[model samples]
Target: MRVLAIIVLALIGSAGAEAREAQEGRADLKHEILKRLHDPNAARRRDALLMLGTFTDVPLSPILHSATDDPDPGVRAAAIMALGHASHASNAQELIPTLLRALKDSHPLVRRAAAGVLGRVRDPRAVRALQEAARDRDAAVRAAAVEALGEQGDQAALTTLLERLRDKDPFVRRQAARAIGRLRAPTALAALLERLVREEDVDVKRAIAWALGEIGNPHAAETLRTLSRSTDPYLSATAREALKRLISDATARSRRR
Candidate 1:
C-alpha cells in the first residue's frame, strides 16, 4: 500500500507540473503571437496565424476571418487552417458554414486546409460538402476530402471511400483504404483484400496492410501470410507484423469467448 501511495503521489506531482508547463507555454506563445500580429510585416503576421493554429490557440475573431483574404496566398491558407482548428477547439458550430464555404475557395490550398478542419469537426453538416470536395480537380484536395470523410466516422462515407480506392491518384487511394479501416466494418474487408492484390504501390499496400490489421479479421491472415513472403523487404516485413497482430487478436477474442 505504501508503494501504491508513493506511485499515486508521483503521478499527481507529474500532472501538476505538466499543467503548469502548459499554462506557461500558452502565455509565452500568446505573447509571441501578439508581437507578430502587430508587426508591420505580413510574413510575421502569417507566422502568428500559424502558431494560432495550434492546440493552445485562441480564435482572434473577425481578424482570422479577414486574414482569410490576405494578399499572400500562404497567409490566407494558414488563416483558413487556423479558423478550422479554432472552431474545433472552441466547439463553434457556427464556424461550420464558413468552413464548408471554404471548401469551395478559389485556391485549392485553401480548400485543402478547410477540408482538414471540417474533418476535425466531424459534424454531419460538413459530410456532403466534403464528399463533393473529394471530387475536386486537385489531387491534394481530393486526398484531403477523403481524409476528412474518414475522420467524420459516418457510415455514409463507406461508399465514397470504396469508390475512391480506384482513384487515379495513389495518395487518395491510400487515404481511402485507411478510412475504410477506420470504419471497422466487416464488409470493407473483402474490398480491401481485392485492392491489396491489384495494388502496385508499396505505400498503398502498406496502408492496406495496416487497415487489415485495424479490421482485425482473421480472414485476412492467409493473404497476409502470402504477402509476408514477398521479395520486397518493406512489404514483407509489414505483412509479417500485421499477420502476427491478427493472430494474437484472434487468439485474444477466442479466449474471451
Candidate 2:
C-alpha cells in the first residue's frame, strides 16, 4: 500500500537524520529532509516526522497535516509533536483537524501528544476537546489535557478546571491547580483561596497560594496579608511574600491609573 511505503520511508529518513543531525552529510541533505515526511518506512517515517519538526516546519505544513492522520500510532504521535514546533499560524491551522482527531485515538500516547500540541496551537475549538480530555481515564492523559486547557487560557474552561481541583487523584488535583495558576481566572480566586485555607497537603496548599498571587486580586491581597500574620510559618511566609508582590503590583497599577 502507498501509505505503508510512506511510513517505511519516513522511518528510514528519520533514522538517517538522527544519525546525521550533527554530521556534515545529513546537515547538507536538505532535500532528503523534505523527502522523509512522506517516507513509507514506519521507522523512517518516525525519524522524518521528528526531523521535519526541526527542519522545514512552515514549508512542510501540508505534510504535517497528512502525518497527523497516519495509520501508525508512532507516526501519528511524532507528527502531532512536530506540529507543536511549527511557528507559522497557517501551518499550525492545517494540523488542527488532525490534532482534534488524535484526541480520540485509541492509543493513549496519541491522545497525550495531541493534547499537548493542541495547547501549542491555541485554537478556540480545542477548548472543548481539552476539557473532555481533562476527564480521561488515564492520569497522564488527564493531566496533559488539563495542562493544554490551561495553556489556551480560555475562560470557557474555567469551571471545568475548578472542578478538577477536587479530582480524587492528588496528581490530577495538583496539575489542575497548577493549570489554574496558568489561567489566573478571577472566578477561580474564591476556590483557590479556600483551598489555601483548608488544604492539608503542603504541595496543594503551596499551589493554591501561588495561584492566588497569580490572579492578583486585591481580595486575595487582603487574605494573603491576613495569612502572613498566622502562626504556621510556611503559610505565613508564603502569604507574606505573595502579599508583598501583590502590594507592589497594586502600587504599579495605581501609579499607571
Candidate 3:
C-alpha cells in the first residue's frame, strides 16, 4: 500500500509539470507570433494574424482588437477570422463590435471577410447586421452576407433573403436563393417557382431548384416533375434527385406522426 501511494503521487507530479511546460511553450509561441504582427510586409503580417488562430483555443484578446484596423485590408480580414478562434467568451465578445464595424469597411474584401466571420461565430445577435450587409454595393459582399445569414438559419432573415433574390448580381441572387433554403423559408416557395421559369442564369436556376427541393412543399413537386424531363441533363438529374429526397423526408415525417 505504501509503495502504490508513492507511485501515484509521482505520476501526478509529472503530469502537473508537463502541463506547466506546455503552458510555457504556448506562451513562447504566442510571443513569437505577436512579434511578426509588426512585420514590414503586409502579407507577412496577415500570415501572422492567421497563425494566431492556431493557438489551441487561446484568446488573442487585446492584439486581435487592434489588428481589426490594420492598414492592410488582408490583415484586417485575417483578424476577422482569428476573432472566431478566440476560446474565451469575453474575448469573443470583443469581436462583435469590430465585426459590425468591419461590415462598413471601405474595402469590400474587409466587409466580405467580416460577414463570413460573423457566420462562423454563429451569434444570433449578428443577424440584423448581416441583413443590412446583404444590400452592400459590392455583389461579393452581398453574397457573403447572404451566406452568413444562411449560417444563422434565422427566420427573421427571411425577408432580407427574399429581397436579395432580385439583386442585380446573379451571384447575390443565387446565394440568396441558397440562403432561403438553409433558412427553410416557406414564403420563398412562390418566388423560387416563379424564378425557375424566367431565370436565365443556369447556376442561379440550379440554386433555386435545390432550394425548392429543400423547402419540399407539395406545390413544388409538379415543377420538379416537369424539370425532371428537361433537355438539360444536369437540371433534369438534380430535379429527379430532389423529388426523391423530398419524398423520403415526407415519408419519414408521416411515419413519425
Clashes of each: 0, 21, 0
* Stronger candidate by lDDT (1 vs 3): 3
Q: In candidate 1, which residue ranges exceed 4 Å CA deviation?
A: 1-42, 54-59, 88-90
TM-score of each: 0.81, 0.74, 0.85
**Residue pair clashes in candidate 1:** none
Between candidates 1 and 2, the lDDT winner: 1
Worst 10 residues of 2 by lDDT: 22-31
- Candidate 1 versus the native: TM-score? 0.81
Which sections of candidate 2 miss by over 4 Å? 1-48, 57-59, 62-66, 69-72, 221-240, 254-257
By TM-score, the better pick of 1 and 3 is 3
Per-residue lDDT for 1-257 in model 3, tens only? 99999999999999999999999998898888889999999998999988897776554767877999899999999888777766445445557888899999999999998898887665666898999999998999999999999988889999999899988899998999999988777788998888778788878887887888899787888888998898888888888988887788788889999
What is the model-wide C-alpha lDDT for candidate 3?
A: 0.86
Error of 3 at 60 (Å): 0.4
lDDT of 1 at 67: 82
Prediction 2 global C-alpha lDDT: 0.80
lDDT of 1 at 147: 93
- Best prediction by lDDT: 3
> How well is each residue in 2-109 modelled by candidate 1, as lDDT tens digits?
999999999999999999999998898787886776677878888888877674445466778878877776777788877766664546676787787778888888
